[model samples]
Target: MGQLVNIAAHSFTAQDLLRMERVLLDALEFRVSNVTAFTALHLLVQGLPGTRPPVAALAVYLLELCLLDYTLLEVPPTHQAAAALLLAMHTHGTAGAQAPRLLRLARVEPAALARAAGRLVRIHRDAARPPTEALGALLAPIVSKYSRPSWCHAALCAPLDAVDPAWCSC
Candidate 1:
């Protein structure tokens, strides 16, 4: 039988979730090789808040979305991070004219990041759709884990289909 990782394990506490959240934030906001790139994410996400899409959470969700698609793995982490950030901003309907400015600050080309983000969006759309029995079997745990109102705060459950087709209209 396949080994099942029990979510109910005492060792697997909310602290683990907290740590994961911090790690994702760190990865998205500070892990780029260039300090300016990290700073760029910080600047872009700082001011926007309050019942709006959680920028940090969206970035992390997009990262998880990327992980599910093997092709995205081939992209450089910096590019992938940039793409995820852009997708997160777009998903929140906050992208507007900020995409190009942020990309310029990160020293990433807008075209490449847009292509990568498009792929991420497509993957998210596929995953967010109602699943068939086999697909449901695969997605159930992921959905269940992120659906927990207490932990991820449903960040992973937010609708990605809301992403605009232009991705970066700006």
Candidate 2:
């Protein structure tokens, strides 16, 4: 039997997710990212187990997305990481645009989603120094936005009046 490597085991931090999201946005914000690119990114992230491994993919994919020829994205380990990196990618006004694609690709389990979100708190604690790039600047916000799953995001995204003190911080 295959030893299913649960992705949550090496969960990504909010800062990590944030940095990744920005790189994705930077790739997509301009003319770089379109629906096809978005879909491709979604396909990439779903295959990877969790958050951290995708960072390397984020860097690689960002370069590929900008360069225009994604043939290299088909390479072995790179393809795998790209899937995971893209899974966590986000942009303003298009935050959940790839949810359906991700759903189809990731088959996200409610338990896994919750577990991953719970793991976000850990990611937050670990992400002390973000990278010095466009993606680096986005670490705080994107992770804050998608660090948790929809259930967590709902409350995290909610107003301070509605938020609980404890879970909100980390």
Candidate 3:
């Protein structure tokens, strides 16, 4: 079973599966090297059973944004996944007691998660702006795909205006 199939078993729709397939095919066709983050994103979703569909979708969206920013490569994939989940939970108003458990599961400290989430926030903000001429074509397809209802319109969700300082105290 492929990673996408495993992910689909959890909460993804058929359209989501197809989109993932297309991405993988494109990567293979282009001979893109070092695509571990994309695999990590799928693993993250698979690891967290019972995650709500919307939250998972949002997390996926955040991780995809990370793929576009080379600076985010400094963060570990597990940390990125954790941070994306944290931000998604907060965005969807599903965060609370489960936050600590999530951190524990990802083996990520609160501080690290906070820093990663902060970076994601910045990426999300920049993604919302009209893209630069150089990268516009590259970024448009991804943003547009996630904006659709099939993907929970994740890209359409408002970027976090501010991450709560207290949330990191966990």
Model 3, 28-50: lDDT tens digits are: 89565564645665666676676
Ranking by TM-score: 3, 1, 2
* Candidate 1 worst ten-residue window by lDDT: 1-10
Evaluate model 3: give its lDDT: 0.79
- Candidate 2 local lDDT, 1-170, one digit each (tens): 11222354536555666677679888887454334434645455555344243343332333332232234333333233233233234311122434344444544443443333333322332232344465445455554544355323421221111112221111
- Give the best candidate by TM-score: 3
Candidate 3 lands at a TM-score of 0.70
lDDT for model 2: 0.37
Candidate 2 clash pair list: 13-123, 18-139, 44-82, 44-83, 44-84, 45-83, 45-84
Winner by TM-score between candidate 3 and candidate 2: 3
lDDT of 1: 0.60
Runs of candidate 1 exceeding 4 Å displacement: 1-53, 130-132, 150-170
- Pairs in clash, predicted candidate 1: none
Model 1 quality (TM-score): 0.56
Best by lDDT: 3
Where is the poorest 10-residue window by lDDT in model 2?
155-164
